[model samples]
Target: MKNFSDIQIGNTIGPREQFVSKDECRAFAHSSGFAAPRFTDDEGARKEGLPGMILPGNMSLGLLSKFVTDWIGPEGGAQLVRISTTYRVPVQPDHTLVFQGFVTHSVPEERTAEIDVWIENEEAERLVTGTATVRFDK
Candidate 1:
């Protein structure tokens, strides 16, 4: 677990990868109340001019959150305070998305850190980009 003192600006956090599966997309759609056919059915997605069934944007955010929290560790005494994201492209199933994050700034007085995060496809095209703020109590 990294304490507030251990976190520093310009620290690279991760390059974790997750394989997006059809079933997982379907499950996320069902659970998230997102009934968009593009997220559940490839044929429907094709009809909409998409490459294939796509994962929900929020699911991608969840992946980013996991990447950050995992890096901070359970005892890191850190909690996410804010996050903003922009989706650059449709994320389709069967693709491996690599998640990466880097600490961009920190405020020791507030025990806060600002991070830049992104997810890219196997071909290295960025699919999502975001900034996150986390606060550490310890």
Candidate 2:
């Protein structure tokens, strides 16, 4: 686990891959209350002006959040203060998603850090982009 003192500006966490299966997409849709056709049904998605069944913004945020939590370790190590994301493209099901991060700022005195986070498709197209702020434990 990376500690607060170990954080450095421009340090990147990953280009790690996660394959989002159709089943996983459907599961997230059901569990997260994003049962919109755009998320659950391909035909419904097309009717809704989407290319096909897609992942919800919240689900994508969860993926990014998990990435952060995994990086800085357990709750005792650091707490995620905030995260914000902008969806650029519909995250389709059954694609390998690439998660990435860059430490943009760190304040040792305040025990805080900010990371630029993103998720990209196998084609390297960015699906979500955001910044996450973390508060380190004393």
Candidate 3:
């Protein structure tokens, strides 16, 4: 079981093996109750000057959370205490996004760690920035 200290500054966890397809986006939107037209209809998205079906913001956030969770292991292994983020751009359906992060701070005695997160496309342009805190019980 990995813990907070296991992750290192400048070390990245994943460009997890998943693709953000239109179908995947729609499914996530449906399951998440995100009913915006841009999230479901390509034409609607085009009208809004977007390329195609837009992924729900929560899905993007969930992906980032999963990357962090996978790095720290199971929920009981290290609990996520806080996360703050800002979406800088949209993730269209074609690119392979690399979700990356680094350890920003640590308090060994308190068993807590802070990490900064960012996601980039195949082109390497950052799309999101976030900060998170996790607590290691063990």
Candidate 4:
């Protein structure tokens, strides 16, 4: 686990990659109550003019959140305060998505840090972009 002091502004963390699969998308859609055919059925997605089955936006956001927390670890004493994301393009199954982050700002007095985060596909197209704020306890 990295402590608050270990985090430096402008430092990059992770290019954690995950290959999205159809089954995973289906499960995420089913469990999240987002029963959209585009998220679970390739044919349905094509009918809707999509390339193939796509993952839910929230699922992608969850991946981004996981990337941050995973880097900090449970004992890092960092509490996520806020996060906001914008989906630029759909993420389809079979694509490898890479999650990465940059420490944008830090306030030592508040023991807080702000990070700029994003996810990119194998083709290097950005799928999601966001910012997160985490406060660390002394």
Compare candidates 2 and 3 on lDDT and give the better one: 2
Pairs clashing in candidate 4?
none
Model 1: residues >4 Å from true position, as ranges? Answer: none
Q: What are the per-residue Cα lDDT tens digits for candidate 4 across 33-96?
A: 9779899999999999999888899898888888888877877677878889999998887878
Per-residue lDDT over 23-109 for candidate 1, one digit per residue giving the tens place of the 0 to 100 score: 998999999997799999999999999988998999988888888888878776788988898989888878888999899999888
Error of 1 at 118 (Å): 0.5
Q: What's model 1's lDDT at 51? A: 87
Residue 16's lDDT within candidate 3 is 58
Per-residue alpha-carbon lDDT of model 2 for 1-138, expressed as tens digits? 556787788999897899998788889989987688888889999998988899988999999999988887664578888999999988998889999999999888988999999999988898899999988875
What TM value does model 3 have? 0.87
Worst 10 residues of 2 by lDDT: 69-78
Q: What is the lDDT for 17 in model 3?
A: 48
Count of residue pairs whose backbone atoms collide, per candidate: 0, 0, 0, 0
TM per candidate comes to 0.95, 0.93, 0.87, 0.93
Model 2 vs. true fold: TM: 0.93
Candidate with maximal lDDT: 2
* lDDT for position 41 in model 1: 97
- Please tell me which predicted candidate would have the highest TM-score against the true structure: 1
